[model samples]
Structure formats: structure tokens, C-alpha cells
Target: MPHYFLDYQDSFHDLVDVDGRELDNDEHAATAARSMLAGRACLEILRGADAVISVRVRRGPTPLFSVTLAITEDRFHLNG
Candidate 1:
């Protein structure tokens, strides 16, 4: 199983597991999980904000196997 972390503005917000169906295989699962995690992270940041600035992916401890999702907001630009 793989773990995912959602960060907002460099702050931890939520964590979740990526569904197996969303991925092609265990390896891809990790990648999709990380991407979804990033989306979730960005959503968290834009939940109440007026606009999204940016979204980013941060490689975690398991860069080769694991990853982190980060979201950033600046003015009216959102990057992911």
C-alpha cells in the first residue's frame, strides 16, 4: 500500500490512499496517487479561497516509489 500527503502552501492538510482502479499497476498507482494527492492538496487550498494560484508536486521520502502533492496560490494564478 502507498500513502499520500496533501500540502497547502507548504503546510500539511490531509492524507489519503490512491484507489487501485485509478492506476494501471502498483508502480503507476503510486504516480496517480501522487497526482491525485496533489489535486486534493490544491483543492484544500482553494476550498475557501477566491482563486487558485498554483499547484505543485513535491517528491517525498520515496521519490523513487512515493511522492507528495503541494498547492500554491498567488493572486489569480494557480499552478499545479
Candidate 2:
């Protein structure tokens, strides 16, 4: 199986800090991460037939966060 990377903006960056409250607070970071992960999981399942997919969140140049899903196929074929 091939590996893929997903990049997205992080809205919780402000909430996550060295103070440890972000991790300790069940209603905050944990909840957000779970929701994001769940969405990614669903996408993976849907794309399983064609390719293996991975989802990741990353911060972009813009202020908003973007969610990226990468799909990698096992074989490569060039056809015009």
C-alpha cells in the first residue's frame, strides 16, 4: 500500500498550548480532533476501492484551515 499525506489549516491552534488544558479539556481539542478524524475515516472507506487514502489537517497561507485528502493508487498507468 502506498502512503499519502493530507494537509489542512488548524483552527484549534490557539486552543492547543503548553498549558496542557487543551488535552485535559475533553470538550475542546479532543472533541474537535475526533470529529475531523471521523470525517477522514469515512472518506477512506469510500475511496478504498480505487486507492488507499489518508487525511490530514494543515495550516495554509490563508487564515482559514484546509482539510486535504490524499489518495494513492497501487499501480501507475499513463494514458492520454
Candidate 3:
């Protein structure tokens, strides 16, 4: 297992995951990020927030992957 950081980003704020997460790889982290943002449980919490937000995955100081969710557009796209 490897440690990865999930940073939450939007126009209003940039939140860094100081604790991070231990996952198998970047793909798993990407899925987790998408799930976290798209899950029903998060709907109420994130409702009325930014239409587009991003989850950035980083291994220590190196960025491995990123996923952006467009709530208004109902789309999810991944980036590196």
C-alpha cells in the first residue's frame, strides 16, 4: 500500500488532506474521490456549493492524478 493525499479544490478554497489516505494505487484513489463527491451522502453536505470541484491525488510531494466533478453538468472527468 501507498499513501496518497486528496486535496479538495474549488474557486473559494483549497483544502489539503494532511492525514491523506492509504490506497493501493492512483486508480483506487480516483474512484474514491469520485465516489466521495458523487455519493448520496455527500449531496446534502455539498449542495449549493461550487458547480465544479476537483480532487487532486498526490504521493507526498508528487501529484499523480486528479478528477473534476461538474455538478451542474452532471459529468466527471479525470486528469493527470
Query: For this target, which candidate reaches the highest TM-score against the unseen true structure?
Result: 3
What TM-score does model 1 achieve against the real structure? 0.33
Which residue pairs overlap in candidate 3's backbone?
Answer: none
Higher-lDDT candidate of 2 and 3: 3
The estimated TM-scores of all candidates read 0.33, 0.31, 0.69
Expressed as tens digits, the lDDT of each residue in 2-44 for candidate 3 is 9989888766668998999899987898888777656632663
Q: How many residue pairs clash in each candidate?
A: 7, 6, 0
Tell me the tens digit of each residue's lDDT in model 2 across 43-71.
65565544322223222222222333444
lDDT string for model 1 (1-80, tens) is: 34433232324333322322333345554556466556665566667544322222223333234444434456676798
Q: After superposition, how far is residue 45 of candidate 1 from its true place, in Å?
A: 0.9
User: Candidate 1 regions off by >4 Å?
Assistant: 1-22, 48-80
How well does model 3 score by local distance difference test? 0.75
Score residue 28 of candidate 2 by CA lDDT: 40
Clashes of 1: 7
lDDT over C-alpha atoms for residue 10 of model 3: 64
The worst-scoring run of ten residues by lDDT in candidate 3 lies at 40-49
Total clashes for model 2 = 6
Clashing pairs in 1: 53-77, 53-78, 53-79, 54-78, 54-79, 55-79, 55-80
